[model samples]
Target: MEAMLEHHDGIALFTICRPEKRNAINFAVMGALEEAMEQAAADPQVKVFAITGAGSEAFCSGGDLSEFGHLRGTEARQMLMRMGELLYRLLTFPKPTAALVNGTAMGGGCELATACDFRFAKEGSRIGFVQGRLGITTGWGGASMLFAKLPYGRALDVLLRAEPMTAEAMEACGWVDAILPAEHWHEQWRERLAPYAERSLSVLQAYKAAAGEKWRTAWFREQFFAEIARCAELWGSAEHEQALRPFLCKK
Candidate 1:
């Protein structure tokens, strides 16, 4: 499946469905998510949106690294811009949002979770930013959001190191808002959101919109444009290609 969007009560859940590849994302999945978010925004019926992967294995592993070899420099930049813009939209979305961290959330997967307002993880989930080992920084603005969400030193430790971090360790850094055993993730998540769901949808949405609007300012756009340029240059490099060799066959 490209992606799945389902609604229960006022919450819309989006799932990335390619578990065989650990839910790696592609252009189609991105577009499906964008469309789902747009629909949620337009409908008065939906008040909360949550994103997660389909399997118990991963939230989102990252971009499909295996798919990177075909596009060079400029084409690659266009792709980055598209995905970055989508994440920006999600980050600034006008309703309550959450990420169900079902398992390992790496690279773009981590970025997707970070874009949401709340990240609720399974106790067993191991979250990390893997871009550094790939010879790049976070490509979809996950780093910027991570910095905003985490305390100064903790943010540095996680984003800079780009290594595996257990749910408890991440919670210590204020990365995971709430954690429960893997089997209890769904029940805990729905319960955590129950209070917000009780409020009038309009009121809840207005509060959500106001908070996001405060940061959805000029500077966010500026950062995005700058990162686009950086990613474009990085995509053209021999070093990045070399580091990505195992994941990408250089077709």
Candidate 2:
């Protein structure tokens, strides 16, 4: 399975399972994530929704270029919008959501983390919104979500730098809620989530709805889609193509 969903102790843990590819997102992973979100959202027993990657090497490396690099123009826009929609769903999910950053996260991976209500990164892990390096802005509505979730200057710093930041640095910047020990991070996150998970599902949903009111607005949706469109335009640019070549070749 490219992804798997496990329900335990009132938490729905959606794991991206392609560790060999550094847990990159592909169509299969996207489909699995969507199904998992739907399933978890409808299940009364699930009080919290969380996402993570399979191994400690990476939480996610973003979209798999090996699979998606061939897309251009309208095809690129369609693909970008698909994940944009998913992240928007996550941003407005009725239940509390968390991103368990077990390892490094880059580009779309950072976008995925931004969509969550909380982020828990393991010690020594790093995160970067490095899509600029590829000549594209955040393609999946992450930049919009980041602006909503964080202060303007902080969010701008993350995007403008386009380089990895340590978990400690991210926590200081308010991007990460907590930094867990590298060992037993799974247990640590579970413990951190326990209080929220112990709450009634309805209560959790109510709080989430209230906290995410801005995200549910049509105005926010417009901005989100607009960001996706901008990134799609960049996706077809010559600079992005040039930058992608060396990265793919090295891979």
Give each model a TM-score.
0.95, 0.98
Cα displacement (Å) at residue 88, model 1: 0.5
State which candidate has the highest lDDT.
2
By summed lDDT, which 10 consecutive residues of candidate 1 come out lowest?
Answer: 242-251
Candidate 1: list runs displaced more than 4 Å: none
All candidates' lDDT scores? 0.83, 0.93
Structure candidate 2, residue pairs in collision: none
Q: Which regions of candidate 2 fall more than 4 Å away from where they truly are?
A: none
Q: lDDT for model 1, please.
A: 0.83
lDDT of 2: 0.93
Best by TM-score: 2
